[model samples]
Target: MKKLLAALVCSLPLVSALAVDVYDRDPDHTFAFFEFNHLGFSTQRERFDKVDATVTLDLENQVGSVEVSIDVRSISTGSSMFNQILLSDTFFDVEKFPVVTFKSTKLNFGKLDDVVSVEGELTIKGITHPLTLTVTQFKCAMHPMLRKSACGLNATGKLRRSEFNLGRFAPLISDQITLLVSMEALKR
Candidate 1:
């Protein structure tokens, strides 16, 4: 009995160390951008102004998940008239669906125990569809200014706006949208 107790006590630190670490998204540093072709004249990009997320990482077990919420009403297009148009029934329909969300179903990890891609479900306009985000860059380190553990990543994904009921002009304004997520999370 004494030996069993001793062994269990000795492994406490190891168990705790392997536990998942939860991080809250730093809203000030996280944003979601969308890019699409505009009449084939040029590429147009816009971003959501409000994003919130919670991320969990288990480096020892090579598992993690992310849940992100974006305010659809906060779309910024650099033009007030265009922004309002996008908020109308043809685009985001912000009055009906005020938020878009992504919840991870799987986290694909690289050899370095880092997340390489995330398989998730994206919800928009009350419809959900499968989406995968490829992590282009990922880094986890002590934040120089915050003096806290932090993780940051740039991820890209693509989806057809028509699938989410956000397609208005189709090929003319572009139905395909490229998703770019620049996110930073702080350990909690």
Candidate 2:
């Protein structure tokens, strides 16, 4: 009985450690920003006000997955006129499609570095396309303010707006849009 009790006590820590949840979506710390060429001369920037995501991290396998959705109507370009025009049919057409989403299918963990490459299907304006995001600096630690375990990652990718059927602006608004994603997940 004594030996059995000792073994059980030793296994408890292991079990608890294995049960630790990883990859939480911290709504306050996550943001998605995009930049695109305007008039063939200048770059225009915009950001979404509302972003939501779900993340799953497998520590034993060193793998992670994420799914994120952004409200199209929440786009902010720092100008009310431009913002309204963007929400119109010429751009995002928020009236018809309210949300844009990305669902990651695979995550390739780096052997020597903290970076991970992610491949996923991005859905926009009712069209889906496969995209690869090179994620750099993925980390997990305790948050001082939230008092919870947090995970952060940065990713960059480019997508052609025309491919998603958002070609109204065409030459006027550049087809290639650069995307930057900064996300923080908190353990639930």
* Model 1: lDDT of residue 148: 97
lDDT by residue (tens digit), candidate 1, 101-187: 999999999999888999999999999999999999998899999999999999999999999988888889898999999999999
**Clash total of candidate 2:** 2
Model 2 Cα lDDT, one tens digit per residue, 132-171: 9888668877888889888789999999989988877777
Poorest stretch of ten by lDDT in candidate 1: 12-21
All candidates' TM-scores?
Answer: 0.93, 0.85
* Top-TM-score candidate index: 1
TM value for model 1: 0.93
lDDT of 1: 0.94
Model 2 stretches astray by more than 4 angstroms: 1-22, 112-115
RMSD after CA superposition, every candidate: 2.2, 4.0
